[model samples]
Structure formats: structure tokens, C-alpha cells
Target: MMLRTIKRLSSRPVHILGLSTYNYSHNSTLSYRKLTTSASSQTIKREEQAETATVKKEEPDEEKPKLSTMLNLDRAQMEKDRLARLKRKKSDDSHVPQAKHIKTLATQTLTFKKEESVDPLPEPSTSRRGPFMTLRDLQERVASYVPRHTQYLDGVVKKTYVEGRERTPNDIKLEEVFQKDTLQTAVLSAYVWEFLWVLQKLNVGECDLVLVLHAKEDEMVHHYRRNLCNIPRTRLCFPNMSGNVNCMHSKLQLLFHLTYLRVVVPTANMTPYDWGEALGTGRSEGVMENSVFIIDFPELPKTSATPDSNPSHTHFSRQLLHFCKAKGLPADIIEKLDKVYDFSRSKPLGFVYSIGGSHHGTEALKNGVCGLATAVRDLGLKTKKPMEVDYVTSSIGSLNKEFLLRMFRALHGDDGKISVQGIPKKYSSRQLAEPAAAADESTESESEEEDQSDNKLWQDIRSSVRVYFPSRRTVAASKGGIQNGGTICFQRKWFNSSTFPQSLLHDCQSVRRGMLMHNKALLT
Candidate 1:
């Protein structure tokens, strides 16, 4: 039983072993399957984690583009808003001030418009007479009437032939005493006749009184006989002396007595003293003063004359301040006179007087007229009186209606109206033409040419005067020195007496030099 059992056991054992092996194989297979499943599950988990990481990295890039676009839009919107605000601010600021200015302008315009709309107009008068009358009418109503013509003596009235006078031992011999006197009388008479002839041509009337102021003794006596006594003796008044002090006094006294209008004959050595003497003595106390006018005759220095020789003897300017001081004239009067009597203002009048007075030196004539005008203006202002001033030319024969008409036209005519091209049709014909026009044109042209020539005459005169009168060296020494090495000299070639037609030296050198120096110092 044992043996059999052993054998069966062995076989059974083999079978059991085989079954165990099979079971082992099955277990291995199952284990392998589980491991494979576990491995696959791990791999799937790793894949899922990698995919998640990649998706996270990719998500930032995608979001970055979207954010950049949104940011750009936001920035554009912000810039637009800022621009809009600035534009609104600028518009507000510009509108505010402009609106205010426009409103103010509109208000001003409206005010002016209303003012113009409400203004009133006056009614015209029905009177037949015109509002403005001529100056002549007023003069006639106010002026005193006097005889048109008066007789005057022809020559010096000698005491020998007086009504009842007999020849006396005191009278000098006729031949010895009267030889020069007679010749002078004759020459003066001729001059007077020529002057009267010229006056007749000018158509002067007899009502006008001829005043001789500051004339030389000989000239005064001569003119008195020839012109004053011969044509209209009653219409003449002699101041009796050549000095300014006497002349002024005579003028004033005559004005009060005759009640006649007189014209002044300004000559060399006539000063403000003469003017004041003649004009200042009128109507002080309940007295009817005469109407007097001034006819300025300015004389220039002689060609041979010098500033150092003394202009006081020949020029009335030196007496101006002295007269003012004596008369106690105000400073304002002096200042006004200086300004109004400037050369530029007095040139036209000065030219007339210079030519009439036969003044040769252009500068002297200009200076004299300027000084006289200044003195007259000052005197008038101080006295509160307006004196009529007329420029009388030696060429003008007389003071007539036609002469006055011509003068008025000449003074008031437009610029260039008196020229040759401006002659009127009526005046173009010889019969109806103004006789004086041609002469006046010639004279004017000559005067213009003379001005150019005479411009240096005064400078030459001053130089000559300085050289001739060395006494003025001290005056010049203080002001550095004289020009041209202290040798002041003038040439005769520069002098033109025909065109100028005036005497520069009427008296001695001492008088002339003193007068010139006095005037120079004062002017300087």
C-alpha cells in the first residue's frame, strides 16, 4: 500500500506541481496586467500635466496682444479728451475780451450818432447889407479929415530975405557962406524933383504926411524944401533933429496936434528912441492923438565899412535897449519883439526899405529892418496899440489908389501868381497892362540875384570892420580868437552898389565903427 501510495503521490505531486505552476503563471499574468495598467495611468497623468503647463504659457501671449490693443484705444481717447479741453479753454478766453471791446466800440459809435442827429442849425438874417465891410469904410468913419494938399518950402529959408529983416554984420558974406549951400540946395532940389516925379507916376495923394526922422541936417533941410514944400508943403513934418531922442518926441507931439496920418522915414542912426519919441507921446490925458503909420527904410553898411568901425552911428539897433531902459519897457515886450522881427519874417519889408533908403550892404539892410521891426512890435505890444506898417519902395512914385490896389494884390496873391506866366489876359495887352509889373519883375529878379551876391557881403563887412577897428580885439580875445589870423579884411569886388543901391557909410569912421561894435556886442 505504501509503495502504491508513493507512486501515486509522486504522480499526484507532479500534477499538483503542474497545477501550482499554472496558477503561478496566471497570477504573474494578472500582476503584469495590473502593472501595465498602473504604468499607463501614470503616463496619462504626466501628459495631462504637460498639456496644462503649455496652455498656461500660451495664455499670457494671447492676453498680451489683447491688452496692448485696449491700452492703445484708452490712450487715444485720453489724448482726444485733453485736446478738447484745451480748445474749449482757448475759445472761452478769446471770446471774453473781444466781446467786451466790441460792446464798448458800439456804445461810442451810438453816442456820436445820436449827438449828430440832435444838433441844431441857426437861421440866416434878412439884412441887405453884407456882414463884412471893407477896412477902408471903417477907417473913413473913425479917421479925422484933413486937407489933401499942403505947401512946403523948396530950400533952406534964409533969414536974410525974411519979411522985414535987414542985412546985418553977423551974417557971413553971401559968396563965401552960400556957395556950397547953394549947390547942395540945387542938388537936393533935383533929388526931390525926381522923388516927386516918381511919386506922381505912382499916383500918391496929398493927404499923406511925409515924416522925416533921424535925417542928416543937410538931407533934412534939402528934402524939406524939394519934396515937402514944393509939391505939398502942408503935408510935411520935420522932426527938426537927426537924433532919435528928438525925432520920437517930435512924432508924438505932431500926432496930437495935427490929427493927421503920418508915415515914418526910417534912416540910418534912427533907433527905437526915435520911434518911441514919435509914437509914445500921444493921448496921455484926454487928448486926441494923431494916426501915424510907419514906413521902414532899412540901410545897409557901406562896402568900405567894418564891424569894428562902430555900427551904432549907422544902425538904430544900439538905441533900442537904451530906449527901453529909459522907458521902463517890460521883458516880455522885448522877447516878443525879438521873435517877430526875425530876418525871415522881415525880409520882404526889409527889401523894400533897403532899396528905398539906398542901402548898399545887404546884411546891414537886413539886420536894420529886422531890428526895427522887432522894436516896433515890442513897443506896440507894450503900449497896447496896433500901428499900421507899410513897406514903401523908392521905386513907387506915390501912394495912390492904383498903387494901393497893386500892393494889396501883391501881398495877397497866390504863390507864383505874380510871375510872368501868371499875367492875366487883360494885363497881357500893353494898354491895360500894369505898368509896374515889368519893373517889379525885373526888380524882384535882380533882388534875388543880389541876395546870392550879398550873402557874403556881411561876412566881409564884419571881417573888414574887425581889422580896421583893432579896439575890438579885446572882445574877440576872450572868445578864443578872430578868424583868418586876426587880419580881418574885405574885398571891394564883393560889393555891388547898383543892384543894392544903398550907402554903407554916411558918416565918419569913428561913428561908423562905434555903431558897428556896439551892435555886434549887443547882438552877440
Candidate 2:
């Protein structure tokens, strides 16, 4: 194809191709030259045409200003254009409301039409009509089923009561002595969960609860956490027993009601077993029997005209208030007892409290063993010169000769006789009934007199006092048996001590056979 093209170009005239004759030496050279020249010219012509076409396609026929051009523009014109665009946009937007705006408008319209008004998503129902869903649902079910308040005599399921008269039973339920229909409760116990459970049974959950227990703070919180409803209303008080006191063993309850305040002093702990609730399954009789002393005080009249408004100067009332103060009770509750409640009814009652630490001087006459003497004296109870006192206790500490003598004297309202003649010189010197007898003997006759006096005192104590405790056999035979008798403790170390009055240890067994006795009573 190249040869044919070259031959064709060679036939053409030099003048037509616009090339000189001197440029070629031979016909072939001339033909090649002609082909080269003609081809080059044609390629150049095509290149120019392509460049022109591309330029025409890519470049605009006329240049237009950039939309954002502002180097030398008129400010007024730019502002005018911007304002016009905004006005047009506003008109467009006004024709169609936004989604949120439309929803708000619909809500307003429906709100005006009571019949067609939309309610919020309905609240979750509390009624048990639906299936059990959450734990709260189960709690509500349980609360509804359980009685809010129960009778103290409710445990006496064995005997039916007559309509007209109240039949007192040999064993009383813990709730029976509760400030009946109490508004609030303050419980002092050694146990936590069982006490809280007892409170639940008494329907005391509705009101505020002040729990003073000898339990760990975390344990108290854990127990109360089970009853989510009472958590807010319950307050736990752990006595500062970090001092001389070992534990908060006070078994007291202050039941506040609308009309009166009931003070309960019970030998029972705040446990179901102690409160007359039977232990183990299918047992109708309670494991232990306890005693309670309950006294009700009417609400003091608002007017000063009433004699009840004046706080009782009675020894019992003053001593009780003092005990409350010492225990760091709520100030408001103590005030209510002192001023808002009538203590005139409490006058005949005798109160005895044993504070832990040593009491000296005048304080000695109002606390511990001495306090018992004070109470007995204040009560004006008839007493023989040689009183035969029987002290029955479920929980007994180490018993010594000196302690028995002091106890005997307290019962006889003669706390002055706090010493034992034959005890160690150190202890005898501190609490000698006759300091002269403890002095150096000046003669053999004087020494004989001192010895005689000591002998007489020792004989008096032995004849007058009797301390009763449950024997191992007695505890084993009880309803709860040996296992549950852990609470009724008398350390082997104390029992084996040489000074222990083994002779005074009369076997204490409850009247109700097979039942343990938790009662602490003084039979004079």
C-alpha cells in the first residue's frame, strides 16, 4: 500500500506538491520524498482539525462569571439577590409544614376534642388480673395475700375464743402485748431477720420502724433489703457497744399509738421461736415460753389543766426515761414519752435496769444490783427480814459467792450489803458491808467477832437466795432439743469455776413439759 501511494504521489507535478526538483537525486528517492512530504502534511492537517474540535468542545463559546465570585462585585446587588432567594425559600417552606410541626398541631387539635383525645400509653397495671411478669408483681401478690395486722393471740389456734370474754392462756403470744393498733414501733433485739419477720406478722410495716439490734450493719441492711417497701421507713440503730458493753441485749419495744404509748419489757428476743411461734414443721406448741410486762399510758391531754400533762415524778417513769436517754434513743420519741404521754398510770410499776459500766457514789444506788434495791424500796412491797428469793434464768453467766450475796441483798432492798466476808481481800475491801470487819484485828476476841460476822453473812446468803438454771438433761428434753438450746447458754468454764455456787443451781424446767423456758423472774 505504501509503494502504490508513493508511485501515485511521484506522478504528480513538483509545482502541485510545492517541492523543488534539487531535493531528490533518483525517481525512488523523489517518490519517497513525495510520499513523506504529502503524508506529513496530511497528518498535520488532521492534527489541527482534531485540536480545533477539542477546543470547541471543551471551552465555552463565552465565559460566564463564577456564582461565588466576590472580588469586585457590588455589595448591594449581592445582598438584594440573597434576600430575594430567601423570600422565595420562605414562601416554599410555608406551603408545606415540617414533620414535627405537623405532629404538634395534630396533638393540639385532638386535645380540644375530649371524646377523641389520645391518652398516654396506659400505666402498667398492679392488679393480679394479668400473668406474673416481674418480681414486683410477685411481691404485690404476696403483700395482698398476707394479713397486714395479726392478733397476739393468733398463735393460740388450739382454743376457740368466746365472743363476750377474753380467755387468757398459759402461754401468751409476742404480739398480744404489742401496743394494740400501734402507729409506729421501736424494737430492741439481739436478732434481726426473725424480728423483722415478727414485725411483718404484726402489720407494723405501715408505720416507721426503729430497729436497735446487736447485729452487723451490713446484715441489718441485707435483711431489710428483702422487704423493699419497708427500706425507706425503717431506721437501724446499732448501739455503740465499743465501750464496756459487749452487746445490745435489750429486749424492749416502745409501741406508739394515736391514744397511748405501750412500753413492753419482755424476756423474749425478737424471734419467732421466742415469740411463741413453734419451731420445725407440724409443731403447734412453741419451743420456749417467755414473760412480758406491758403497761399502757394514755395520751397526755393537750391542756395543762390535766394532772397527766405534768410528767410523772414516779421512780419508774424517771428511771425509764433515764434508760432511754442512756441508750441514745430518738429525741422525739423520748420527748413524747416524757411530755406527750401520761405516766400517771406507770407510778405503781417498779423499773430496774442494769447499765453495763461501773456506777459509783449516788449513781451506784440507781444502776445494776443497787438499782434493784432502789426499785424494790420505791415500790413499797412488803418484804421479810430474811427474804427467800428464787431467781430463774435461761441465760446465766458465771455465778460466784460474792455475786450471790450482792443479788440477795438487792432482793432484800439492802444494796448496802454488797460484800462477801470470805471473798478475796481486794474485792472485799471495795464492797465491805462493815468496813470495820475488814480492818486489822487488834485482839483475838476482835478477830473472833469478825470471823463470826463473816460466818453469819455467808449463812444468810445461802439460806435466802436460790439461782435456777436448766440442767443439760433438761435442755436435751425440751421441744427444740439440744440444737435450739444454743441460745440458752451457760459456759462450761464458768460452771466449773471453784467459786461457782453449785449448791444454788436448782434444775430449771418449764411447767409445760418438753418446752424450754426463757423466762427470767424473781419469785420472792
**lDDT of all the models against the reference?**
0.26, 0.53
The positional error of residue 5 in candidate 1, measured at the CA in angstroms, is 99
User: How well does each candidate superpose onto the true structure, as a TM-score?
Assistant: 0.16, 0.59
- The TM-score leader among the candidates is 2
Top candidate when judged by lDDT against the true structure: 2
What is candidate 2's CA lDDT for residue 503? 76
Candidate 1 structure quality by residue, lDDT tens digits, 1-524: 00001111111210100011112122322121111222343453343244322323211221222222212223234334434543553454443232243235446745743444211111112222221323553344335322222101111111111111233322111121112110111101011122321222111221222333334467656654563443321233333233333323221111111222111222211122111111122211110111122222122324533533433231232343233333323444333222222122122221112112222222221223333333333333223122222231111122222223222222322121222122333333332234667756654674475346444543433232211222334324422233311222223333332333122222212221211121111110
Report residue 210 deviation for candidate 2 (angstroms). 1.1
Per-residue lDDT, model 2, residue 190, is 52
List candidate 1 segments past 4 Å from native: 1-194, 197-203, 213-223, 230-234, 239-523
**Tens-place lDDT digits, model 2, residues 1-524:** 01101111112211112111122223312121111222343453343244322322222111111111112223345345444543553454433222233235445644633332122212223333321134564354344431223222112122111111222453344434542233455545454335324543443324566767664355654554443332324676655565566666788778775455667777777767676665534355567767776666766667743433454446878898888877777777677777876676666767788766655546667777778877887788636476777888888787786676656656666533233122343343344333555443323354465456656767877777787888999998877789878778789999899998777788997666776777788888
Model 1 whole-model lDDT (C-alpha atoms): 0.26
